[model samples]
Target: MIHRRSGSVGAGAVDGGAGWDGVEPQDYDDPSLGGVRKHELIGEAEGARQYRMRYFEVPPGGRTARERHPHDHGVMIVSGRARVTLGSETHEVGEGDVVYVAGDELHCFEALGDEPLGFVCVVGPRSAS
Candidate 1:
């Protein structure tokens, strides 16, 4: 069976590709997080037990908490640019680029340029770190 969900272009959203239908805009556990939201795209309700797919949009200059978890995650850059911090290293990424964060690896993402950094991430059910 196919569990399909559609997302529309967000109004004033950077690159117009970061909003999802029926998905609520939620914030992460970061103090410095600028105006942003995370959308859950798929999960157990959709029969995905091993992993969960989620989308996040960080406004320009926004950043995620530099934290780590026991579960690994993979992120696919879907829009805009980002300055990603992995451990003690940093890198610039854009659309179509993929990022992998191993279990317990210190990681963070900061929006670059004038656009919101949006990405779709597939991760273990524990958390999106």
Candidate 2:
């Protein structure tokens, strides 16, 4: 994964003046697998760090399989809603809500609204397995 900086302007839209540049939105290809699209924010960070943002158009009854990551992941809801199941605990996430996933924890995500659910995902450096 190539670690790409979000450019000058970020989510907070800070003003860096003259040379300030904004991060361009990149699209993820997944037309064959529903309408799931991922826009990577920060691919590879300096040293041991990684960050990414993803958008999903999950269909009704659609759900992500249980998966584990070697790094701690954090997610912030931007639009719509979702039912995130982390182990035996399930919670609803909506706009302005942030969810954190512990490293190596079993987790699953599901769309909880009639429309597609979109969110930003940020992950830390991957720990040795």
Candidate 1 C-alpha error for residue 43, in Å = 1.5
Model 1 C-alpha lDDT per residue in residues 1-129, reported as the tens digit of each score: 443445443234644545556666677656467576787778766777789888888888888888888898899988888999999999999988999998999999898888778888888975544
lDDT of 2 at 90: 95
lDDT for each residue of candidate 2 in 1-129, tens digit (9 for 90 to 100): 343433332222112211112333333343444534454445443233444444333443445556777778788776566899887899988778999999878887776646556667777644552
Best by lDDT: 1
Evaluated against the true structure, the overall lDDT of model 1 is 0.78
Clashing pairs in 2: 3-44
Cand. 2 Cα-lDDT: 0.56
C-alpha lDDT values of all predictions: 0.78, 0.56
Candidate 1 regions with alpha-carbon error over 4 angstroms = 1-11, 14-17, 127-129
TM-score of each: 0.83, 0.62
